[model samples]
Target: MIDFLTAGLVLGCSAGFSPGPLLMLVISETLTHGTRSGVRVALSPIITDFPIIAATLLLLMNLSGYHGILGGLSLAGGLFVLYTGYHSLTARPVQLDLPKEPPKSLRKGVLTNLLSPHPYLFWITVGAPLLTRSLKVGPAAFVAFIGSFYLCLVGAKIVLALAVGRSRAFMGSRAYLWIMRLLGALLTFFALLLFREGLKLLGVG
Candidate 1:
Protein backbone atom coordinates (compact mmCIF):
# COMPACT_ATOMS: atom_id res chain seq x y z
CA MET A 1 0.00 0.00 0.00
CA ILE A 2 2.72 2.41 1.00
CA ASP A 3 4.73 1.52 -2.06
CA PHE A 4 1.81 2.06 -4.37
CA LEU A 5 0.98 5.38 -2.75
CA THR A 6 4.55 6.55 -3.04
CA ALA A 7 4.76 5.45 -6.66
CA GLY A 8 1.50 7.24 -7.46
CA LEU A 9 2.64 10.46 -5.83
CA VAL A 10 5.98 10.47 -7.62
CA LEU A 11 4.52 9.66 -11.02
CA GLY A 12 1.64 12.06 -10.52
CA CYS A 13 3.89 14.93 -9.57
CA SER A 14 6.19 14.21 -12.47
CA ALA A 15 3.30 14.09 -14.92
CA GLY A 16 1.82 17.28 -13.46
CA PHE A 17 5.06 19.26 -13.59
CA SER A 18 6.31 17.84 -16.85
CA PRO A 19 6.41 20.29 -19.75
CA GLY A 20 3.83 19.25 -22.28
CA PRO A 21 1.01 20.51 -24.42
CA LEU A 22 -1.51 20.18 -21.61
CA LEU A 23 0.64 22.22 -19.26
CA MET A 24 1.15 24.85 -21.92
CA LEU A 25 -2.61 25.06 -22.23
CA VAL A 26 -2.88 25.54 -18.51
CA ILE A 27 -0.52 28.47 -18.59
CA SER A 28 -2.16 29.92 -21.66
CA GLU A 29 -5.57 29.75 -20.04
CA THR A 30 -4.28 31.30 -16.87
CA LEU A 31 -2.57 34.15 -18.67
CA THR A 32 -5.43 34.72 -21.04
CA HIS A 33 -8.43 34.23 -18.86
CA GLY A 34 -7.65 33.77 -15.17
CA THR A 35 -6.52 31.36 -12.46
CA ARG A 36 -9.90 29.73 -12.43
CA SER A 37 -9.67 28.95 -16.10
CA GLY A 38 -6.25 27.39 -15.71
CA VAL A 39 -7.53 25.34 -12.80
CA ARG A 40 -10.32 23.99 -14.96
CA VAL A 41 -7.67 22.89 -17.39
CA ALA A 42 -5.78 21.17 -14.60
CA LEU A 43 -8.83 19.18 -13.67
CA SER A 44 -9.11 17.76 -17.16
CA PRO A 45 -7.20 14.56 -16.57
CA ILE A 46 -9.71 13.59 -13.90
CA ILE A 47 -12.28 13.70 -16.65
CA THR A 48 -10.22 12.19 -19.44
CA ASP A 49 -7.80 9.63 -17.98
CA PHE A 50 -10.28 7.15 -16.57
CA PRO A 51 -11.63 6.04 -19.92
CA ILE A 52 -8.15 5.67 -21.30
CA ILE A 53 -7.13 3.72 -18.24
CA ALA A 54 -10.12 1.46 -18.55
CA ALA A 55 -9.46 0.70 -22.15
CA THR A 56 -5.79 -0.02 -21.53
CA LEU A 57 -6.56 -2.20 -18.55
CA LEU A 58 -8.96 -4.26 -20.65
CA LEU A 59 -6.33 -4.68 -23.35
CA LEU A 60 -3.66 -5.73 -20.89
CA MET A 61 -5.93 -8.18 -19.14
CA ASN A 62 -6.07 -10.28 -22.27
CA LEU A 63 -2.28 -10.53 -22.32
CA SER A 64 -1.78 -10.97 -18.60
CA GLY A 65 -0.52 -14.50 -18.86
CA TYR A 66 2.33 -13.59 -21.13
CA HIS A 67 5.37 -12.50 -19.16
CA GLY A 68 7.35 -11.67 -22.28
CA ILE A 69 4.70 -9.26 -23.47
CA LEU A 70 4.36 -7.66 -20.07
CA GLY A 71 8.14 -7.34 -19.85
CA GLY A 72 8.19 -5.72 -23.23
CA LEU A 73 5.51 -3.29 -22.18
CA SER A 74 7.48 -2.37 -19.09
CA LEU A 75 10.55 -1.73 -21.19
CA ALA A 76 8.50 0.43 -23.50
CA GLY A 77 7.19 2.33 -20.54
CA GLY A 78 10.73 2.90 -19.27
CA LEU A 79 11.80 4.24 -22.63
CA PHE A 80 8.83 6.57 -22.69
CA VAL A 81 9.55 7.84 -19.22
CA LEU A 82 13.19 8.33 -20.13
CA TYR A 83 12.12 10.36 -23.11
CA THR A 84 9.79 12.46 -20.97
CA GLY A 85 12.54 13.07 -18.44
CA TYR A 86 14.96 14.11 -21.17
CA HIS A 87 12.47 16.69 -22.33
CA SER A 88 12.07 17.96 -18.81
CA LEU A 89 15.82 18.23 -18.38
CA THR A 90 15.96 20.25 -21.55
CA ALA A 91 12.82 22.28 -20.84
CA ARG A 92 12.72 25.90 -21.85
CA PRO A 93 10.51 28.74 -20.70
CA VAL A 94 7.24 28.73 -22.56
CA GLN A 95 6.33 31.75 -24.62
CA LEU A 96 2.81 32.50 -23.56
CA ASP A 97 0.88 33.89 -26.49
CA LEU A 98 -2.69 34.41 -25.54
CA PRO A 99 -5.22 32.77 -27.75
CA LYS A 100 -7.39 35.21 -29.68
CA GLU A 101 -10.59 33.55 -28.67
CA PRO A 102 -13.02 33.06 -25.86
CA PRO A 103 -12.18 31.07 -22.77
CA LYS A 104 -13.30 27.43 -22.79
CA SER A 105 -10.83 26.12 -20.33
CA LEU A 106 -12.44 22.82 -19.36
CA ARG A 107 -13.66 22.02 -22.83
CA LYS A 108 -10.35 22.83 -24.46
CA GLY A 109 -8.45 20.86 -21.88
CA VAL A 110 -10.72 17.83 -22.25
CA LEU A 111 -10.43 17.92 -26.00
CA THR A 112 -6.66 18.32 -25.90
CA ASN A 113 -6.17 15.46 -23.47
CA LEU A 114 -8.61 13.22 -25.28
CA LEU A 115 -6.83 13.71 -28.55
CA SER A 116 -3.29 13.43 -27.19
CA PRO A 117 -1.35 10.19 -27.51
CA HIS A 118 0.50 10.55 -24.24
CA PRO A 119 -2.29 9.39 -21.98
CA TYR A 120 -3.03 6.35 -24.11
CA LEU A 121 0.59 5.36 -24.34
CA PHE A 122 1.20 5.89 -20.66
CA TRP A 123 -1.80 3.86 -19.62
CA ILE A 124 -1.15 1.01 -22.03
CA THR A 125 2.50 0.66 -21.16
CA VAL A 126 2.84 1.76 -17.56
CA GLY A 127 -0.41 2.61 -15.82
CA ALA A 128 -2.47 -0.44 -16.66
CA PRO A 129 0.24 -2.84 -15.59
CA LEU A 130 0.62 -1.05 -12.31
CA LEU A 131 -3.13 -1.05 -11.86
CA THR A 132 -3.32 -4.76 -12.59
CA ARG A 133 -0.72 -5.42 -9.92
CA SER A 134 -2.51 -3.26 -7.41
CA LEU A 135 -5.73 -5.18 -7.92
CA LYS A 136 -3.92 -8.31 -6.80
CA VAL A 137 -3.08 -6.58 -3.55
CA GLY A 138 -6.68 -5.48 -2.97
CA PRO A 139 -9.26 -2.97 -4.11
CA ALA A 140 -8.11 -0.59 -1.39
CA ALA A 141 -4.59 -0.64 -2.72
CA PHE A 142 -5.84 0.06 -6.21
CA VAL A 143 -7.86 2.97 -4.96
CA ALA A 144 -4.92 4.30 -2.99
CA PHE A 145 -2.67 4.22 -6.04
CA ILE A 146 -5.14 5.93 -8.35
CA GLY A 147 -6.45 8.34 -5.74
CA SER A 148 -3.01 9.55 -4.78
CA PHE A 149 -2.04 9.79 -8.44
CA TYR A 150 -4.82 12.18 -9.41
CA LEU A 151 -4.61 14.04 -6.14
CA CYS A 152 -1.04 15.07 -6.79
CA LEU A 153 -1.60 15.37 -10.52
CA VAL A 154 -4.47 17.85 -10.24
CA GLY A 155 -3.14 19.47 -7.10
CA ALA A 156 0.21 20.31 -8.62
CA LYS A 157 -1.41 21.88 -11.66
CA ILE A 158 -3.84 23.79 -9.48
CA VAL A 159 -0.92 25.14 -7.53
CA LEU A 160 0.73 26.08 -10.79
CA ALA A 161 -2.42 27.92 -11.83
CA LEU A 162 -2.38 29.84 -8.58
CA ALA A 163 1.30 30.66 -8.95
CA VAL A 164 0.92 31.78 -12.53
CA GLY A 165 -2.07 33.86 -11.59
CA ARG A 166 -0.10 35.58 -8.85
CA SER A 167 2.92 36.23 -11.05
CA ARG A 168 2.51 36.19 -14.77
CA ALA A 169 6.23 35.60 -15.19
CA PHE A 170 6.22 32.50 -13.05
CA MET A 171 6.28 30.14 -16.02
CA GLY A 172 9.61 31.48 -17.21
CA SER A 173 11.23 31.89 -13.83
CA ARG A 174 14.47 30.28 -12.68
CA ALA A 175 12.53 28.59 -9.92
CA TYR A 176 10.33 26.78 -12.40
CA LEU A 177 13.31 25.61 -14.40
CA TRP A 178 15.05 24.26 -11.31
CA ILE A 179 11.93 22.52 -10.14
CA MET A 180 11.45 20.80 -13.49
CA ARG A 181 15.09 19.78 -13.55
CA LEU A 182 14.69 18.21 -10.13
CA LEU A 183 11.62 16.29 -11.29
CA GLY A 184 13.51 15.20 -14.36
CA ALA A 185 16.20 13.75 -12.15
CA LEU A 186 13.59 11.88 -10.15
CA LEU A 187 11.98 10.61 -13.34
CA THR A 188 15.32 9.31 -14.54
CA PHE A 189 15.59 7.32 -11.35
CA PHE A 190 12.10 5.94 -11.85
CA ALA A 191 12.92 5.02 -15.42
CA LEU A 192 15.91 3.05 -14.28
CA LEU A 193 13.72 1.25 -11.79
CA LEU A 194 11.26 0.44 -14.53
CA PHE A 195 14.05 -0.98 -16.61
CA ARG A 196 15.08 -3.16 -13.70
CA GLU A 197 11.54 -4.37 -13.28
CA GLY A 198 11.29 -5.13 -16.95
CA LEU A 199 14.50 -7.09 -16.86
CA LYS A 200 13.33 -9.05 -13.86
CA LEU A 201 10.09 -9.90 -15.58
CA LEU A 202 12.08 -11.12 -18.54
CA GLY A 203 14.15 -13.32 -16.19
CA VAL A 204 17.30 -11.53 -17.24
CA GLY A 205 18.04 -9.64 -14.02
Candidate 2:
Protein backbone atom coordinates (compact mmCIF):
# COMPACT_ATOMS: atom_id res chain seq x y z
CA MET A 1 0.00 0.00 0.00
CA ILE A 2 2.76 2.39 0.89
CA ASP A 3 4.53 1.43 -2.29
CA PHE A 4 1.44 2.16 -4.35
CA LEU A 5 1.02 5.55 -2.71
CA THR A 6 4.67 6.38 -3.23
CA ALA A 7 4.56 5.33 -6.87
CA GLY A 8 1.42 7.32 -7.46
CA LEU A 9 2.90 10.45 -5.91
CA VAL A 10 6.19 10.17 -7.75
CA LEU A 11 4.61 9.42 -11.11
CA GLY A 12 2.11 12.19 -10.71
CA CYS A 13 4.70 14.78 -9.73
CA SER A 14 7.02 13.71 -12.52
CA ALA A 15 4.29 13.88 -15.13
CA GLY A 16 3.17 17.28 -13.92
CA PHE A 17 6.64 18.76 -13.76
CA SER A 18 7.82 17.32 -17.03
CA PRO A 19 7.66 19.59 -20.08
CA GLY A 20 4.67 18.79 -22.28
CA PRO A 21 1.91 20.45 -24.24
CA LEU A 22 -0.30 20.82 -21.18
CA LEU A 23 2.52 22.29 -19.13
CA MET A 24 3.26 24.76 -21.91
CA LEU A 25 -0.36 25.80 -21.99
CA VAL A 26 -0.38 26.27 -18.24
CA ILE A 27 2.69 28.48 -18.39
CA SER A 28 1.31 30.44 -21.30
CA GLU A 29 -2.06 31.01 -19.65
CA THR A 30 -0.52 32.02 -16.35
CA LEU A 31 1.81 34.42 -18.10
CA THR A 32 -1.07 35.97 -19.99
CA HIS A 33 -4.15 35.88 -17.77
CA GLY A 34 -3.09 35.12 -14.18
CA THR A 35 -2.35 32.32 -11.76
CA ARG A 36 -6.08 31.59 -11.42
CA SER A 37 -6.35 30.89 -15.15
CA GLY A 38 -3.37 28.62 -15.05
CA VAL A 39 -4.88 26.80 -12.06
CA ARG A 40 -8.03 26.07 -14.05
CA VAL A 41 -5.81 24.53 -16.69
CA ALA A 42 -4.03 22.51 -14.01
CA LEU A 43 -7.40 21.19 -12.84
CA SER A 44 -8.30 20.04 -16.36
CA PRO A 45 -7.09 16.52 -15.69
CA ILE A 46 -9.73 16.12 -12.97
CA ILE A 47 -12.44 16.83 -15.47
CA THR A 48 -10.98 14.89 -18.38
CA ASP A 49 -9.54 11.78 -16.72
CA PHE A 50 -12.72 10.30 -15.19
CA PRO A 51 -14.06 8.98 -18.47
CA ILE A 52 -10.59 7.85 -19.49
CA ILE A 53 -10.08 5.92 -16.26
CA ALA A 54 -13.50 4.32 -16.46
CA ALA A 55 -13.02 3.27 -20.07
CA THR A 56 -9.51 1.93 -19.50
CA LEU A 57 -10.67 -0.02 -16.45
CA LEU A 58 -13.61 -1.48 -18.34
CA LEU A 59 -11.48 -2.54 -21.27
CA LEU A 60 -8.84 -4.11 -19.08
CA MET A 61 -11.42 -5.93 -16.99
CA ASN A 62 -12.92 -7.44 -20.11
CA LEU A 63 -9.48 -8.53 -21.29
CA SER A 64 -8.37 -9.85 -17.91
CA GLY A 65 -8.53 -13.46 -19.05
CA TYR A 66 -5.69 -12.85 -21.51
CA HIS A 67 -2.46 -12.52 -19.62
CA GLY A 68 -0.52 -12.27 -22.85
CA ILE A 69 -2.38 -9.17 -23.88
CA LEU A 70 -1.86 -7.60 -20.49
CA GLY A 71 1.81 -8.50 -20.56
CA GLY A 72 2.23 -6.90 -23.94
CA LEU A 73 0.60 -3.74 -22.73
CA SER A 74 2.90 -3.70 -19.71
CA LEU A 75 5.93 -3.97 -21.96
CA ALA A 76 4.66 -1.22 -24.21
CA GLY A 77 4.00 1.00 -21.23
CA GLY A 78 7.47 0.33 -19.88
CA LEU A 79 9.03 1.33 -23.16
CA PHE A 80 6.92 4.48 -23.29
CA VAL A 81 8.02 5.49 -19.78
CA LEU A 82 11.62 4.87 -20.74
CA TYR A 83 11.19 7.16 -23.71
CA THR A 84 9.74 9.87 -21.50
CA GLY A 85 12.53 9.46 -18.97
CA TYR A 86 15.19 9.70 -21.63
CA HIS A 87 13.75 12.98 -22.85
CA SER A 88 13.57 14.30 -19.31
CA LEU A 89 17.20 13.41 -18.72
CA THR A 90 18.14 15.45 -21.79
CA ALA A 91 15.60 18.27 -21.32
CA ARG A 92 16.60 21.84 -22.04
CA PRO A 93 15.03 24.96 -20.60
CA VAL A 94 11.72 25.74 -22.25
CA GLN A 95 11.35 28.72 -24.53
CA LEU A 96 7.93 30.06 -23.67
CA ASP A 97 6.75 32.21 -26.55
CA LEU A 98 3.36 33.35 -25.37
CA PRO A 99 0.60 33.10 -27.91
CA LYS A 100 -1.17 36.24 -29.09
CA GLU A 101 -4.67 34.94 -28.52
CA PRO A 102 -6.53 35.70 -25.31
CA PRO A 103 -6.40 32.90 -22.79
CA LYS A 104 -9.30 30.48 -22.95
CA SER A 105 -7.40 28.45 -20.45
CA LEU A 106 -10.10 26.03 -19.31
CA ARG A 107 -11.46 25.10 -22.69
CA LYS A 108 -8.04 24.79 -24.27
CA GLY A 109 -6.80 22.71 -21.39
CA VAL A 110 -9.74 20.30 -21.58
CA LEU A 111 -9.28 19.87 -25.31
CA THR A 112 -5.53 19.42 -25.06
CA ASN A 113 -5.80 16.83 -22.28
CA LEU A 114 -8.59 14.93 -24.00
CA LEU A 115 -6.79 14.86 -27.31
CA SER A 116 -3.42 13.88 -25.85
CA PRO A 117 -2.45 10.24 -26.37
CA HIS A 118 -0.18 10.04 -23.35
CA PRO A 119 -3.01 10.12 -20.81
CA TYR A 120 -4.98 7.44 -22.61
CA LEU A 121 -2.00 5.17 -23.07
CA PHE A 122 -0.92 5.65 -19.47
CA TRP A 123 -4.31 4.86 -17.90
CA ILE A 124 -4.85 1.80 -20.07
CA THR A 125 -1.43 0.22 -19.75
CA VAL A 126 0.29 1.42 -16.59
CA GLY A 127 -2.37 2.91 -14.32
CA ALA A 128 -5.04 0.25 -14.80
CA PRO A 129 -2.86 -2.65 -13.70
CA LEU A 130 -1.55 -0.79 -10.71
CA LEU A 131 -5.07 0.28 -9.75
CA THR A 132 -6.43 -3.24 -10.05
CA ARG A 133 -3.64 -4.64 -7.89
CA SER A 134 -4.05 -1.89 -5.34
CA LEU A 135 -7.79 -2.56 -5.05
CA LYS A 136 -7.14 -6.18 -4.08
CA VAL A 137 -4.97 -5.02 -1.19
CA GLY A 138 -7.72 -2.68 0.13
CA PRO A 139 -10.01 0.12 -0.94
CA ALA A 140 -7.97 2.56 1.10
CA ALA A 141 -4.89 1.68 -0.84
CA PHE A 142 -6.70 2.20 -4.12
CA VAL A 143 -8.08 5.52 -2.98
CA ALA A 144 -4.73 6.59 -1.64
CA PHE A 145 -3.07 5.83 -4.95
CA ILE A 146 -5.58 7.83 -6.97
CA GLY A 147 -5.97 10.67 -4.49
CA SER A 148 -2.26 11.16 -4.00
CA PHE A 149 -1.71 10.97 -7.75
CA TYR A 150 -4.03 13.83 -8.66
CA LEU A 151 -3.08 15.86 -5.61
CA CYS A 152 0.58 15.88 -6.53
CA LEU A 153 -0.11 16.10 -10.25
CA VAL A 154 -2.26 19.18 -9.99
CA GLY A 155 -0.28 20.61 -7.07
CA ALA A 156 2.98 20.54 -9.00
CA LYS A 157 1.44 22.32 -11.96
CA ILE A 158 -0.09 24.93 -9.67
CA VAL A 159 3.28 25.59 -8.09
CA LEU A 160 4.86 25.91 -11.51
CA ALA A 161 2.19 28.35 -12.59
CA LEU A 162 2.75 30.48 -9.52
CA ALA A 163 6.47 30.43 -9.93
CA VAL A 164 6.34 31.34 -13.59
CA GLY A 165 3.83 34.06 -12.92
CA ARG A 166 6.30 35.62 -10.51
CA SER A 167 9.37 35.15 -12.68
CA ARG A 168 10.48 33.04 -15.65
CA ALA A 169 13.98 32.66 -14.21
CA PHE A 170 12.96 29.49 -12.42
CA MET A 171 12.64 27.65 -15.73
CA GLY A 172 16.31 28.12 -16.57
CA SER A 173 17.66 27.65 -13.05
CA ARG A 174 20.10 24.86 -12.16
CA ALA A 175 17.52 23.65 -9.64
CA TYR A 176 15.14 22.99 -12.52
CA LEU A 177 17.69 20.79 -14.29
CA TRP A 178 18.40 18.87 -11.10
CA ILE A 179 14.69 18.31 -10.50
CA MET A 180 14.18 17.04 -14.05
CA ARG A 181 17.15 14.69 -13.77
CA LEU A 182 15.86 13.33 -10.48
CA LEU A 183 12.42 12.75 -11.99
CA GLY A 184 14.06 11.07 -14.99
CA ALA A 185 15.86 8.65 -12.67
CA LEU A 186 12.66 7.87 -10.77
CA LEU A 187 10.76 7.26 -14.00
CA THR A 188 13.51 5.01 -15.32
CA PHE A 189 13.35 2.98 -12.10
CA PHE A 190 9.58 2.59 -12.45
CA ALA A 191 10.02 1.60 -16.08
CA LEU A 192 12.40 -1.18 -15.05
CA LEU A 193 9.93 -2.45 -12.47
CA LEU A 194 7.19 -2.48 -15.07
CA PHE A 195 9.43 -4.29 -17.53
CA ARG A 196 10.25 -6.97 -14.96
CA GLU A 197 6.56 -7.42 -14.18
CA GLY A 198 5.86 -7.70 -17.87
CA LEU A 199 8.49 -10.38 -18.31
CA LYS A 200 7.10 -12.30 -15.34
CA LEU A 201 3.60 -12.16 -16.76
CA LEU A 202 4.90 -13.36 -20.11
CA GLY A 203 6.56 -16.33 -18.36
CA VAL A 204 9.97 -15.07 -19.44
CA GLY A 205 11.36 -14.27 -15.98
Q: Residue by residue across 4-121, what tens digits does model 2's lDDT show? A: 8987987898889999989999998998899999999999999999899988888887877788988898899899888888888998888897886787899999999999888988
Specify the poorest-scoring 10-residue window by lDDT in model 2: 1-10
Candidate 2: list runs displaced more than 4 Å.
Answer: none
lDDT (tens digit, per residue) of candidate 1 on 75-122: 998998888888888888867777766999999999999998888888
Clashing pairs in 2: none
Worst 10 residues of 1 by lDDT: 1-10
The C-alpha TM-scores of every prediction are 0.95, 0.96
Give candidates' CA RMSD values in order. Answer: 1.5, 1.4
CA lDDT for candidate 2: 0.87
Q: What lDDT does each candidate get?
A: 0.87, 0.87
RMSD of 2: 1.4
Point out where model 1 deviates above 4 Å: none
